[model samples]
Target chain A: MKIIARVLIILSAALLVVGATMAFASSASSGSGGIGPGRDGFERRPPAGAAEGSRPPGFLPGGAFGRGEGRGDHEGGRGMPAAFELLKNLVIIAVIIAISTLISRLTDGLRPQRR
Target chain B: MKPEHRTYIRARSNLLIDVATFIAFLIATAPRLSGIGIHEWLGIAFAAAIIVHLLLHWQWIVALSKTMLRKARASSRLGYLLNLALFIDVTLLTFTGLMISEVALPLFGLRLPRGFLWRGLHSTTSNIAVLLIGLHLALHWQWVLKTTARIFGLVRPTAKPRQEVSQ
Candidate 1:
């Protein structure tokens, strides 16, 4: 059991290091162009014929739903609907929990007899 | 108490930890399911509880190596192995959670990384962790029940609590 525990710990540490490295590399490469709260540098300006200052067809600005579209509302981008985005996030969280729980059970079942 | 008795007590304690962890997980995830911020708050509370839980079992961890070296008990060994994995999984989940841009709640003005990879990994690991936790619970169903009955005073010394209560 100790050996197994040690092995698992080592493996987990390695994975964490790898994950961190990958994340760092990606961030370094993508710079400010990554998808997130801040504006990506690579994001292009609205194309011709697109309503000036109007959020693109699907994209809703972060504060859109909370404050309602004000007079300054103009720039729009193509993005998932707010409701959809929220739902997607919720679904992802739920699925992750479900999977972890399942794996835990499988591991428990593999325990040897204690008596 | 005899060695067996001591073993039973430790096992029972471990079982209680599992149940608490499971409940915490449920509360933490429920908000996400309903698409509400409540889940995020609950998750933070859960994380705090988990930290406490780990601290409480620190001694067992210290003795883990000695115990494993002294005995060839398979079930006990396997339990330890699973626990080790669980520790890792939970740690990753917590870290990744802090990486996501979304704030369920902010702490001391601290914010999680808003990078693309952080978000992606956080999402992926979260799913895997959930499934693993479910399996952990199912595998320890007996321990869960035993600990639950003990907590509720449903476990009797001489007979099953249900029978004693009814009589």
Candidate 2:
């Protein structure tokens, strides 16, 4: 029962965040002649270039969101190769861990010794 | 189970799940290699894993919350703040992913409006997540190494829980 309550609390918090985001987006869009219920009670037409089946350029070969969009060896949307990006992320993680270890050691060194 | 056995089991479980979560994060970060379908599905799975991670550490969360403003160690306070930021960033990342979902939501016959805003937010949040997750793992690096050594039998498991176990 306690576990259930905790799960419920988590779900409620997540829902609140989602709800707030949607509400803020709706209001923002409504103010800017956005996509909301039209005078005819239909969704106002999707914004220009926000058309259906359009995908943004991405590093992934099959594009970012949709399936079967692009499926061959092609350069990433970014000028660099995809492998380089992967290496970059890995290197960043390694560097962060190394620095953290150094800081942990430094803090321990600064602390008073326990006899 | 004996208390020592229980402690060992818990340590092992924590190590396995944390490793899995780290791998999932890595794969999800690289949609280019995993493809869009795997990336989206893995992201949804990652969200579930994160909740489980928190559930496993619920006691620490409660205890820390009770004393965060008072007697908690400076490192613990810093960790708590980092975790809070991670939770918020990941929440936004998952929510925005769902909002801009093209493959997963459509499978359920629920097609949300595709907006540039959702897409942009998803990208931004994911970028922030990389840094946050890096810090999170770094903070726990000692625990991870020690746990792995114990689990692999290079070092015997201790009966007493370490101070850092609260994290």
| TM-score per candidate, chains pooled | 0.52, 0.83
lDDT of 1 by residue, B18-114 (tens): 5676566654543323333554555566655666565555555556657776763665576577766766666665655554424463544765433
Candidate 1 regions off by >4 Å?
Answer: A1-115, B1-20, B34-36, B69-72, B104-107, B111-113, B151-154, B158-167
Q: Candidate 1, which CAPRI tier?
A: incorrect
lDDT of 2 by residue, A53-85 (tens): 443443232224333322212213444554554
lDDT of each prediction vs. the true structure? 0.50, 0.75
Instruction: Write one digit per residue (lDDT tens) for candidate 1, span A1-115.
Output: 8656655655566477657655665565565542332332113334567653554221244412232211111111123243443344345545655665676678779978698
lDDT of 1: 0.50
User: Per-residue alpha-carbon lDDT of model 2 for B1-167, expressed as tens digits?
Assistant: 77777777887898899899888888777766776688789999999998899888888888999999999998899999999888888888898888767688889998775455666667778878888989999988988898899888899767676743476
Q: In candidate 2, how many Å is residue B14 off?
A: 1.1
Chain B, candidate 1: TM-score: 0.67
> Residue B166: error of model 2 in Å?
1.6
Residue A79 local lDDT, model 2: 45
